[model samples]
Target: MVAFASLKCIIISSLLLPSEAFAPQSNLVNKKVSESSTSLAGVGKVVNRVKDSLLSKERSREDLKIGIAGFYDRSSQIWEEVWGEHMHHGYYVPEDRTDHVQAQIDLIDEVLKWAGVPEPTGDNKDELPKKCVDVGCGIGGSSRHIAKKYGCTANGITLSPYQAGRGNELAKEQGVDDLCSFQVADALEQPFEDNTFDLIWSLESGEHMPDKEKFVNELFRVATPGGRIIIVTWCHRDLEEGEEGLTKKEEKLLAKINRAYYLPRWCSVDDYVRILKENGAVDIKREDWSYIIAPFWKAVIKSSLNLKSLVGLLKSGFSTQRGAYAMFLMLRGFNKGLIKFGLITCTKPKE
Candidate 1:
């Protein structure tokens, strides 16, 4: 939990954007998002009931979707409420921020290595829009990194207005504000010309998208010929030979994950790769990285349970109880082999 005073200090000192820029209405969901406010309202209503069913202190998968969604919706509020305490809102934080930053660079290096793009030259270090977009650019952390490292401007698109404003502020603080810009827009209906970006980065955000095909196709459409797209996402492992698939208990757990974390479904990596290939993305390489994620969350749970964390949660009004439940689901999903981590790198033909 993060104290309100701390949050206020962080927001006030770090964010100096114009009111229009930070306002909720300024950011908009991606294109093709349903405009049915009533639908959202209704979902919000049932979200609670579903959550209660899922987190009843007993294992059950019936109504898992509702349970999962409820957990997520609750968790989202808590994350936002205590944004100052958890950098990047509980996304994995590398032990060192600089190391985390460099890892992203290495990820990009891997992508460019595969895409066959020539290394940059000294003469053209500062370039604009030479073709990179970070989908789900939460808080613009990665966008700022890319801008600083490559001297190229990258458009970051996200649905959360709060994240966009804060991300821009961080950009300014880091002196990369000029090169990186964040908009409250949906990645699905990205507002860019077709065949525009040389690289499309979708990092751990695919699970939130309901229409996986459309999501990948949008990436394909925006990417130039010979361009590359790198996607890292959370997935559910493939069904085993004689096991019941996605028991009600599991569905509820996943739904809790979705609701709390804003994911739609934890689809399989095979499904994701197939979607990319179906949409004309070629030479797809897919790998399951669940081995890394499960243990990662286990450590987070331990850290969160520390004495300082307990004290912080009690002092802050934010619901750390809900946060613990979410972590539990995440850990359990990972341990049971129901959850998976996946990465895919694909390229569009130059011709």
Candidate 2:
């Protein structure tokens, strides 16, 4: 039964995965491999069969940017048409019926509120940041939101040229182009002057970074002293005291996910806290929002089931299709407690 379950997980997993836009991303591939994560791992030959079936390939570090850029470039417009901007997970609570697109918007506001991004002045008079940077910025959704909300200039970066161009075009149409700018750039080596941005926001993009510490270091380097940085991302669960790395089962699950999503080795929120501290960041805080975002993948799965989603996906090409089917693994990982929707916030100490 364990082998059967493991086979099921890998088969579904080996199939491919998605954006937090998860829904309308545009659909889960086939349901044959749809067993839970608890049923995955320790099934060797079946893993090979599933991998072969999916034709999943491991990308090198050199190819990470290319792979990620390709995935988004092919999939972003399809998702924008189907899911409506905000290509990240939605915030949800039991019995709450907010529309999914709005829920995605709510996540940005919720994360900033939790981070005390503006430091809560109680009079809506908190010092608005003069300049902000959205690292791993996808399609300029959050950038435009921040720019429009605070009247601040917001700059965004992405590896996908399509995203950079489309995001800029969308901002122009939305009348926020003057306040929002986007470029194709690497997050590990950011392209801004030092002591620049006062607020750094990275939503969901940290999952794609190959170097966690370098990502943090870059954020710190670009930030003004006293700047606030918030990273809301996907992370593996923290290791318990006395444990080493993730258990073999967890590794298997995440490995399949890595192949699907072009992710590098994952770290925990605890690891992030350590990195922030090492970088001399102050006021560190972290939280796990697994429960609150539980509805996200389910919503995505539902959205991807329709005809329009399918037609759009078919045209988006192979990797996007693989990503579409692999989304169930995201749910299975969450259900099994191997994956976490993590939030971490810290401030560069004023010097």
Candidate 1, lDDT over the whole model? 0.56
TM-score for model 2? 0.83
What is the C-alpha local distance difference test score of candidate 2? 0.73
In terms of TM-score, the best-performing candidate is 2
lDDT by candidate, in order shown: 0.56, 0.73
Give the TM-score (vs. native) of candidate 1.
Answer: 0.67
Instruction: Give stretches of model 2 more than 4 Å off.
Output: 1-50, 53-58, 119-126, 307-316
Residue lDDT tens for model 2, 321-345: 4454445566678789988889999
TM-score of each: 0.67, 0.83
Residue 156 in candidate 2, Cα distance off native in Å? 0.2
Question: Number of clashing residue pairs in every model?
Answer: 17, 11
